[model samples]
Target chain A: MNPVGRIGLIVTVTAVAIHFTGVAYAQADFEGIWNPQHPPRMGQPDPASVRLTPEGQAEYESYGPDKDPTLRCLMPGIPLGLVDPYPLEIVQQDHQILLLYEHFHQVRRIFMDGREAPDHWLPSIGGYSTGHWEGETLVVRTTLMSPDNYTWTNGFPYSGDEDAYVIERYRRDGDELTFTGEVHDPRYYEEPYVVNGRWNFAPDGEIWEYECIPEFGGIQ
Target chain B: MLFIGFSATAHHNGATYFDISTELEHSDATVVSYDLVNPHGRLVYVFMDDEGNEVEWRAELPSANNARRRGLGGDLFRPGDRLTALTGSPSRSGANFMRLTRVLFANGDVAQITGRNAGVVRAGTE
Candidate 1:
């Protein structure tokens, strides 16, 4: 081959390799066990900051620790489950991401296969999650949560109806993971509820089995 | 290495059951039973009142796993083990219940069971 032709081919191959490497880097790797770097403070929103509607205000007023579903061993659901003071494992696959929490043995699957919620889907505590990657952050949108659940911020208020939804952004930087979320429920609040949390990579961390028996202490 | 940042935020709100602002102390308490379980660990013990009457108290500790990591074992407090000091938040309902915070073993060891200073154990008399 001519010298100029050989040089051109080499340049083309190197450019292709670099491009693929950039693509791989863009797909952040968040698969590992993570221990919370700080306490997961989900529902501790400032009462003055939260703009609750009349229904939400009424529900907040009626809130009591005795009525906390968690005391009954009910699943804490989204923001609460995500911020619990326990270790969690993140497993990423080509089509979905799985979050395995040591709290209440909760497991959440975030579908990435471009699927939509069924028209007649039943609401659940964990709800339905769909995720996509933008740059190095994983953005997830969750909906169809059960209305029976509670949102703990300034006060423990009932979660809004089926229309309640949550949007979460997860970004990993070195050994640190940052999470930000927005809870939207027009029925409950005049503004979206926002929360932030952080976790550190636990190289030797393991998720243990969680068996919640509400009658353990006989206090209830 | 010890893991920190496991906050006091557990399954239920502690304020609902205990008066967190007040601290109650029991010295030379005899352990009746210790159930190391999830959600929270319960420690039942008996101490003498000012009138020399035996009083039974139930104190809540962290989960079994968190307790283990903080140097508490199932056998750490046996049926007859004596605690040099047991301090916690008293129950608001006027019951003999508390949210355990610090435990001082008869041998001088100390375990901070909850709060910002949780997961710390100081060896004593070894």
Candidate 2:
């Protein structure tokens, strides 16, 4: 073939390759608004059921309602926000997964671009999250969370702070998504605490804005 | 790097605001008003004391978003509407303050406004 014919064939092959790649990424559909099956606030776990260290037990017992930081309009951190009453939206891209919770308008990003956690990074309430897909399940690992943050509400300490670790597995079955999370904090619990919940897909549902007005009863 | 707006609303520890150890006093009262605002919803009502004197009661519920989701909106109540409430026992023996439990409207409408124990009421409260 002539030079022009050869160039035309190369362009056609490149276009086909790009189209197939786009289709491959689109196959993982975890995007949409979802509501947890049961949003747990109170009656989550009895103190006896939680295996706490001596220091952890003292911290939990010292939690005073008036001194609660969340009442002052602070972040409730992980697991608590995961099963909030308001719906959360999941937006997946090639490089990351974004979680947008309706309550307090919290947003969490799970990087999927093959980056390792940085050393001596600043602690964050949302922590540093990295995710990978295992077949249909998306497993996420989060670390470097702020020590001041609470793993579960009511003063469940996440004292691990810089060393705090969280692993979450998200699996989608039809329109229902299940979240199984494990939190490990050597400074708090004697063992990893498990968190389980479900979210149903809501195509037409929208997570309304949660504008917190202090002194107006900002509970969560 | 994309951060979405987060409002510090909903999911506060109820134990801090309420005395959960004591039983909620189930009483029949009249809906004086309901402020369906953000942060939290307030329900104002009046009930009769042991001596038959009128006692005003103000209770807090979940956020407007959760209330709206449970079919309890601004239009749900009006002044003079009869309601059955499970009120939180006051910290002091005779304090007039009461926290709210599930609310039963005169029209047979029931809402678990407290945001917990959904669809399940105390064995005898229902």
Candidate 3:
């Protein structure tokens, strides 16, 4: 083909790729404004799993509320953000999932859609989350976390171990998409810990940045 | 994950009280039929079924000062019992994870491992 013709073809191909990428992001829940349709807050609360035994209670009590992670601006990490009742925008890519949260505007990247979990994984604040489709759910299993960064808002909380698995089941019915998760901490809980909540889709919802500022003296 | 059946009760602001401790421990909870929203200041929350969905509660974090010594004793469950809970704390949506501050059990029993008693154990030599 002539130089002019070849140039036009390349441009056309690039445009097609870009258009497809935009379409893909537009179709995902992670990329739009999402509000918690059913969160486990105390009043008419929706909680995660509950299996904190007496022993588990003892251990957890030692780590009581004053040291709550949210009191600080620490990252809520991977699957934790999914249930944290914050609006998050997902910047989806062919190989990675960028989880953006409204809580702190914290963003987590998961290499889903066929990328290998990193070897020599670093102990992360949120760790790492990888996902794929299992029928209607996008099953995600996370690993490589340091138990020091998370908080337990229910019967039992994640202790940041290899055995601690966070599973996310996401599905959409009509305009709203629902994502539920189960956190299993074998050492803490006596059974398969499960928690449930839902989301309301806001196609027009916009993501605002989260800026956490520490109290200068006694002010939060 | 399973959605355990919720205990039916009424609370303030048209909120219904439900115990998820049993659900988390024993029964598989179905979708929690409640309003989910952006957590204003929650330490942790869970994604029951939505990708960006979250819920808050009471929990014990690692910073409770003297937790390592106050270890878990007498297994609370036998691997198949259900435990559900409810929390007042909301999730901090911008963090790496969510937290539930004060955890309660299925039978209206709140978890308390706060080491009302304290002791220590020596490491055994191999």
Question: TM-score of chain B, per candidate?
Answer: 0.81, 0.70, 0.29
DockQ for each numbered candidate? 0.22, 0.28, 0.02
Candidate 2: clashing residue pairs, number: 8
RMSD of 1: 6.4
Report residue A102 deviation for candidate 1 (angstroms).
1.0
Model 2: CAPRI class: acceptable
Who wins the DockQ comparison?
2
The Cα RMSD of model 3 versus the native structure comes to 19.2
Give the Cα error of residue A141 in candidate 1, in Å: 0.8
Candidate 1 Cα deviation (angstroms), residue A65: 2.8
Model 1 residue A54 CA deviation in Å: 2.9
Over A40-97, each residue of candidate 2 has an lDDT whose tens digit, in order, gives: 5422455457888899899888865544444556666664454555688999888788
Error at A56, model 3, angstroms: 2.1
lDDT of 3 at B120: 24
Model 3 spans > 4 angstroms off: A1-30, A40-49, A53-55, A78-80, A216-220, B1-126
True contacts kept of each: 0.13, 0.46, 0.00
Better of 1 and 2 by TM-score: 1
Which runs in model 1 stand beyond 4 Å of their true positions? A1-26, A39-43, A153-155, A217-220, B1-12, B120-126
